[model samples]
Target chain A: MSEKNKSDMLRAPFKLEYDYERSTGPIIGKFFEGLSNQQILGTKNGDNVYVPAAEFDPITYEHLSEFVELPETGTVKSFTWIDQPRKHHLINKPFAFALIQIDGATSSILHMITNCNESDIEVGSRVKVSWSEEKTETIKDISHFELINE
Target chain B: MSEEKKDHFISPISLDYNYTAGAATTRFLKKVSEGKIVGQKCPKCTAVYVPPRGSCPRCGVATEEEVELVDKGSVESFTIVHIPIPGNPIVPPYVCAMIRLEGANISFLHLIQEIDLKDIRIGMRVEAVWKDKSEWDTTLENIKWFKPSGGDDIDPSEYRFKGPE
Candidate 1:
């Protein structure tokens, strides 16, 4: 064995692999079931029904059961610019994901915006779902929220 | 908040992984219990891998040939572990290291025993000290630890040990 051989061995590498599972709770479960039925549902907290049901009532802290249908059209209450997206997000490129308060709903649902460039997105923009001809009980089934014309 | 029955919160954090390994490693552990060191050779690149890998990471092909590596090697890098990791058998305040076996292209981690922690050094020549045959299992721990090879302390800069370049 040569001394040179000892120096080179110090930088050897090792590789490992691992598998993981995630748990989805009751709220997300009901949302998925609703998507499977091709209907979006929300829960009424008090006087106003939220587009996406609250897991826990904001004021009362009790479980909500009242479900209601909201119009697909909604006004973007707020949004964040995603110049780079994560692997599991609906869109992989630059997009505006927003919280939209749909008609007949008091609270907003979190979703992504697509089918247009980032420059066109704004806080008051109207967006609608580009529903799949075939739907599943998942948010991804809606493809992405598309900007709607006034 | 009540004085005797106040609100309390509890949080749970844990790590569990479904550890998977390549076929080559399965064979290596099986052989380790028998007090043998095994490696696989990449025919094209000529790099030997201990705890053999299914494919050559550098050449991008399966390493088909199995080679028996020498039990003797030298410490490439080492650390004095003062903190104990849960599930590790050894108590803390021990020395652990990557030992590059002679004639093999990679290093394997194991405990270093029978030496003062302060005396252990990089490039120290050591050889496998195996467990009694009756206690051998499919684990690297079958070899108790690498004991110092009775040779004189060679200069760290010129300690010639076998391994890949």
Candidate 2:
């Protein structure tokens, strides 16, 4: 084929973009605000407490309004070791994405666990939230969970 | 309860796509780049389709015959866009029309220009205005826009397809 034909058959670059601005409503909005101040907050639905503050009762389906301040330290319920990290991952090095059940909260919150090896961590391992030096009103405000000395 | 303003956040998203134009579309686009209009004719219904799909939508049979279509055709329907939108190829107050090419069974949507927006009417004759030969490519963008072909308007009844009652 000719050079002109080759050029004609070349694929064109196309990009799709969407810029969206939205409100987080009353429930999740307060959760992000607490993260900005380096505090962990949850919502209590009767006997059960949700760490990643749910907007509604998981069981009753009623709107949840009761807020509970949760301790930063928790135990790792389950974790998976990432031997190799991808570019989009929060941490560049190997880390574990774990479900940590914070103190006084019944439901566990999923987060990254770092500053330890694969062999050093397991289920029921003690961990604490590590606050970022620069806090933003986002989940990234808590850098990652670290292994507790105890 | 004290009335407090709800907090809002902005999130920006971007995605890229690499599409492969298959066999039938590749043939149609190649002819378009060569300053020609080609359509695939359905064997069962004799319907000719521009930007030819490999198979007939109604008959569900393969369209194998290539039919050359005229650049001039009639505008079956049109609407003048009055509201401005982001990333629009053309400004507001322009006309977008569904044009049925002569000798083709289907009508396709394209921008109509070089005529008064209000003057654009049903069955108005129009023709494709192609870009420079050097700028031509295997894409519909090669045809810059459809403009009034300067002829008497055809009767809408003649172009309208009568479906089974």
DockQ of each: 0.03, 0.49
Write the residue-wise lDDT of candidate 2 on A34-147 in tens digits. 988888999998789998899998888999999999889999999999979986677999899999999999999999999899999999999999999886577788999999
Give the winner by TM-score: 2
What are the clash counts of all predictions, listed in order? 0, 0
What is the alpha-carbon interface RMSD for each candidate?
Answer: 11.9, 2.7
Q: Per-residue CA lDDT of candidate 1, range A6-32, in tens?
A: 433222133342333333346655655
Off by over 4 Å in 1: A1-150, B1-12, B86-89, B152-165
Report residue A108 deviation for candidate 2 (angstroms): 2.3
Please give, as one word, the docking class of candidate 1. Answer: incorrect
Global lDDT scores for all candidate models: 0.74, 0.86
Q: What's the lDDT for residue B91 in model 2?
A: 83
